[model samples]
Target: MDSKNRAKWACFGEIFEAVAQQGIDELDAVEALLAALRNGLRAYGYRRQFTFNESGKVERLPRDIYPQPVPVAIWRDSGTPKGDLTSIWQDDPEEPEVWISIDWVSGAVESLDWELTNFEHLRTDFSAIRIPRKEADHLLSDLAGRPKKRAGRPLGPSSPWEKEQVAAALRMIDGGDTRPATAIATGLTDTALIGKALESQQRRLTWGIKTALTGNAKNSANNKRD
Candidate 1:
């Protein structure tokens, strides 16, 4: 090869190497964060908790279910340091971790993860309460129960982005924030679904979806109970 062509190929190899290294770095970072989250959960006596169906319905987690109360949090959002936290990354792998901004709370019997974010603390602040064992037992009873569902309607794994959009629509509805003028203002194409979501109180589209988005992140111990 000519000297000029040889040099061009060398530079191309270097650029390609850099890109590959960056992808490796991103994957390593994601894996490390997931490991740390699971480690903390183990330390706090928390288990896999629950798994969501394809449609996002909640189901028991079987053996990995927490034997006792354990403070936990999940990925909420990205781009802010508030209870409304956000993560900004585009490295989506085949089985990407949801990468929740979870923190180990200090003390409290049980509080809705969403409610905990509303404390006077900054969006970046972490707060947890210590709960007495006896009190925690009573408080944690019925913390997770099977959602009301129709027979023979099953959901399976779905694309994460698709789940997020569908869940977002449901959340907007559950909050009773259905305003028809919203479609007129935003010009979203799926106005019909949005309209039904606002007018209908469908649990399958509501709780089912949220469960699927934030379902059990750990699969090291796979145990499903029907």
Candidate 2:
């Protein structure tokens, strides 16, 4: 959890303690107190996103819509100072405030640090405590007030296994060797090579499916065939 939310949860415990002595053992009172504490924490929340223009004033980006926090590696390349990100990001804030610092390892903006933050809440969620992946997702979904993010498009069917198979096939082709030799080099059995070849053929078919469905191959003979 971020420091602010951490403080809020801590304050909630304090509120519970103070009110427990008041003979308010009821759930409603406790819930109300917790809600009030959350509201107070929300009040202290600052705007992180912003819009900028040379001809006009900039408006603060809404916090509720902040992007999901992503873990980014900060590195300094050769001949450059450490923790300097001036080369990585845009030099001007004339664009929208799409990036914000959530937590820095060194507590300094220019320090070589890892920033852990949620960006675009539309695509992410936040929670009070860390949990296992399955439970964590369920908890976030329960707390989400807005529409949840989509699963997003798949890149392709090609994975590491397929990559190795393809590389082996290419090496065999380069050495003017036969398919059996390629299978041996790839550590795949003859049957496995046959399966992989079929899979590759299917992958090509799927790519064609995409082209036909999306009209992305408009100028190609592949499209003319349809």
The clash numbers for all candidates, in the given order, read 20, 12
Residue-level lDDT of model 1, residues 63-182, one tens digit each, is: 443234343343223212232122332124364333234322221121112223433211122223122333222222212222544585334213354345555655665688565423
Question: What TM-score goes with each of the models?
Answer: 0.17, 0.18
Ten contiguous residues with the weakest lDDT in model 1: 105-114
* Candidate 2: 10-residue stretch with minimal lDDT: 102-111
Query: For candidate 2, lDDT tens digit of each residue in 135-198?
Result: 3233233333337668843433345654454455455555775444324333432343467565
Candidate 2, lDDT over the whole model: 0.34
**CA deviation > 4 Å runs, candidate 1:** 1-42, 61-97, 103-226
RMSD of 2: 20.5
What's the lDDT for all of these models?
0.34, 0.34
